[model samples]
Structure formats: C-alpha cells, structure tokens
Target: MTIYQKVQAVNHLFNQLDKDLGSFQQSTGLGCVANCGLCCLKPDINATALEFLPLAYHLLLNGETEQWLEQLQNNTEDKLCPVLNKVIAPGSKGFCSDYAHRGLICRLFGFSAMLHKNNTPTLVTCKPIKEQKPEAVAKANAHIASKDNYPLISNYYMQLRSIDESLGEELFPIRIAIEKAIYAVLAYYAYRELPSKDDIV
Candidate 1:
C-alpha cells in the first residue's frame, strides 16, 4: 500500500480504538486525572513508527517535517516524548501538543487490557489510576474478564501489523519512533508526487 493508504489505515484503527475505549471508560469510570500528563514524562516510553505515521504526515503537510526532525535530533537528553507539552510550573498538568495524532500506546494505556501468561486479561494501566480508582479498576478488570468486547492490546497491535509489518513490529524510544515515521513519509514523497491541500485534510 501507499504511504497515504497506510496512514489512513492506521488512523482508521485509531478511530475505532477511540470509540471502543470511550465505551470502555464509560463502563468502568476509570480515566486519567484531569489535565494530568505524568505518564508522558516517563523517560522510557517506547513506540512503533507505524503509530506515528499520522503525526509525521501532519508535519509534512504543514511544512514542518524538517523542523520536527531537527527538534527531535536535538533532544539527546531527558528523552521525554517530544510530542509531550510538559508543564513547567509546579503542580500544573502537561498535555500533548498533537493529541489527535498521538500514538496507539497513548490511547491504550488507561483503557485497554493485555492477556497475562495464564491467559487471563489484565488491565494495563498506570499507578495513579490504580491508587486513585481502586474500585473502578477492580470493576474494570472484572468487566474485561467477563466480557470479550473490551479492547485487547494484542489484537489492536495485530491490526497495526496487518497495515505494514515492518513499521508496526519494532519499538523504539518515543522520539526515535517519531523520527523514523517522519523519515518514512519523507522518503515516500521523495520519488513521488507531493500531496495537495485536500489530501491531508
């Protein structure tokens, strides 16, 4: 498939996941604390290039791909996700600069489940949710166990791989994944026609 096709497929997957997660969140009442972005501050966050394809394509359409590449290259320290707009003031919450184009992990963290070795589904969530919403978390786990409709991390990832196996399978530090996605788009257009205004929107 073409680069744009791959991006569309990924975005479609994201859209469906968003809807499912919304329902899952409504059912469980487990959600992120308002304006909280501590999860984005983690230094070891990893992702796949496929998940960032939409973000890369967005930068490309906005004529900011090179600028983003430079910014990512300059981020040799701290290694936080460059997409994360970190809050500088004490006690303030940060946010994603490009929320609409955030990767799958961003969407999955608090609202999805993973199969444990014993084949039971466990909600893969952060400590804040566990600590603050203990009852909800427990209820959500039970919901996942009893219902097959809850989003499964493995199933979503498998769908991603079906789009483009190469970009979907490997994981890199968040910035690196974004960089690779940018490069993939750049290379795609290098020898082909550029997108028009209507193409990206």
Candidate 2:
C-alpha cells in the first residue's frame, strides 16, 4: 500500500480500538480523571513512527509539517511531548493539541490490557486510578481476566506492525516517532506523485 493507504488503514483500526476502549471504560467504570494530563507529562513514553502516520499526514496537508519538523529537530531540552499544550504555571495538567490523531500509545495507555506470563490478560493502568479507585481497579482487573473483548496491548501493537513491519515495530521516544513519521511522509511525497484529495476515498 501507499503511505496514505497505510495511514487510512491504521486510522480505521484506531477508530475501532477507540470504540472498544470506550465500551471497556463503560463496563468497568474506570477512566482517566477529568482534564488530567499527567500521562501526557511522562518523559519516557515510547511510540512507533507508523503510529503517528495519520497525524503527520494531517499536518502535511495543513501546511504545518515543516514547522513542526523543525521544532522536533531543534527541541532537545524538554522531554514532554511537543504536542502537549502545557499551562504557563509549572506542574499543571495540560492537554494534547492533536487529540483526534494521537498515537496508539496515547490511546491505549490508560485502558488496555497486557498479557501475563501464563498467557492471561492483565489490565494495565495508571497509578492515580489504582490509588483513587482501588475497588474499581480490582473489579476491572477481574473483568479483564474473564472477558475477551477488552483491547490488548500486545495484540494492537502486533496489528500496528502488520501495517508496516519496519516502521511500525521500531519504538522511539514519542517526539522522535513524530519526527520520523513526518519525515517518512515528506520523503514519500517528495519522490512520488502526490495523490489527489479524492484518492483518499
């Protein structure tokens, strides 16, 4: 598939995963706190270039890719996500500027499951949820152990790798992933004919 086709396919998968995660949250009564962007503040969050293809493509179409690319290239001090919109005051919760096109790690971090050594699924969650809602966390873990519908971290990641073995499987710091994704899209379009807008249909 072309780069655009791969992006559309991955995005379609992401949309379905989002729906599944929403349903899981509803069933378990576990969710991210309102306006809580603590997860986005993590400095070590890792992602793959392929996961950000849609975001990169969107920026490219909007004529913002080069500016953001420059930012990524030059940004060396801040470990927080470049897309995160932080408050002026220090230690405040922030928001993702590009929520709709966020990467897979962003989508799955708070509401997904990981596989145990014995092959059972374990609900992987955040500290705030565990501390503030211990009962809910326990119940969600039980539900995950018994249910087959919750999104699995390994499963979705494998699905991502299937889209493009090289780019999708290589993990990097989230910012670098974003930069690589932008570079991939830019390089692809630089050498090939740009698709007509309707070609996306």
Candidate 3:
C-alpha cells in the first residue's frame, strides 16, 4: 500500500478511537490523569512497523528522517523512547517528541480496552488511574461490560493486515519496531524514486 493510504488508515482509526473514548468518558467519568507518563517510561513496550508509519512520514516531511534514524541507531541499547523528554521542568510530564505520528502501541497504552476470556471487555490502563480513581474504575468497568467499546488492537490489526500482510503480521521488540518503521518509510520513498525492477520473489 502507498504511504498516503497508510496515513489515511491511521487517521480513520484514531477518529474512531476518539469517538469511543469520548463516549466511554461520558459514561464513566474516568480518564488518565494529566501529566502522568508512567506507561511511556516503561522499558519494554513493543509496536509494529505499520504503527510507526505515520511517525516516519512526519520525519520525512520535516526533513529529520535521517537524523532521527541516526539517533535511534546510536541509542539502540537505551530503552527510552526517542520522543520522550527525560529532563523537563519540575512537575512537568516528559512528552512525546512526535505526538502526531506516535505508534499504535503509543496510542493504545494508556486509554484503550481489551477483550477478556469470559466474553467481557477490560480497560488496559496504566497504574496511576488504578490508584487515584477507584470509583471511576467501578464505573468504567461497567461501561466495559456493556461491550460497545472501540475496536481493539486485534481488529484494527486485522484491517491493517488486509492492506498489507507483512505490516500487520510482523511483530518486533519496541526498538526494533521503531527501527523497522523508520526504514520502511525511508525505503518506501527510495523505492518510489527508483525505476521499477522485477524481483524474483
């Protein structure tokens, strides 16, 4: 699929998520706290190449693609997200450097829901919410039980897979995922600029 088409897909999914989260908040009166970056600080969150495509596009548009790739390569062993700002003003949350094109895992980590084995839905949320808002938790759980929530990762991924199986199907470590996504975007433009050649796949 073309890069533009990929971007369109992410936008559509994000809109759907916005609607779903709005409804959920109206019903449950719950949300992730402002300035909480615990999940973002986690060392092991993973993502797919497709999830980072938008970030890649943004990097290219701003002419920072190669620079960011070099940054990632130089920091391969560091678990911190490229977008995270470790040093910030006191009481300020470290922010995503590329919030607009953040990966699916980035988007999904704090606010989304997942399906449970007993045919129920569960909020896949971060720790702060669990501690700070016990009552909201009860209400949100009720909302989840109603089952009219946003499309889960599995569903969105299925749709993405239909567009390009490789993107939808391949999973990688968080660093690797980011690397692949960057390379995917770069290679895409490079390929677009090249003459068409037959590959004996």
**What local distance difference test score does each model get?**
0.90, 0.86, 0.70
Instruction: Give the candidate number with the greatest TM-score.
Output: 1
Q: Could you give candidate 3's per-residue lDDT for residues 76-195 as a string of tens digits?
A: 788877777665667554467656667777766645677779756677776789889878887777766776565365666676566567875787776677778778777878857622
**Which scores better on TM-score, 1 or 3?**
1
Candidate 1 deviates by what RMSD? 2.2
**lDDT per residue (tens digit) for residues 145-191 in model 1:** 89658999999999999999999999999999999999999999999
Q: Which of 2 and 3 is the better model by TM-score?
A: 2
Task: State the TM-score for model 2.
Answer: 0.91
Would you estimate the TM-scores of all the predictions?
A: 0.94, 0.91, 0.85
Candidate 2 Cα lDDT to native = 0.86
Model 1 lDDT at residue 125: 90
Best by lDDT: 1
Rank all candidate structures by their TM-score, best first, as comma-separated numbers.
1, 2, 3
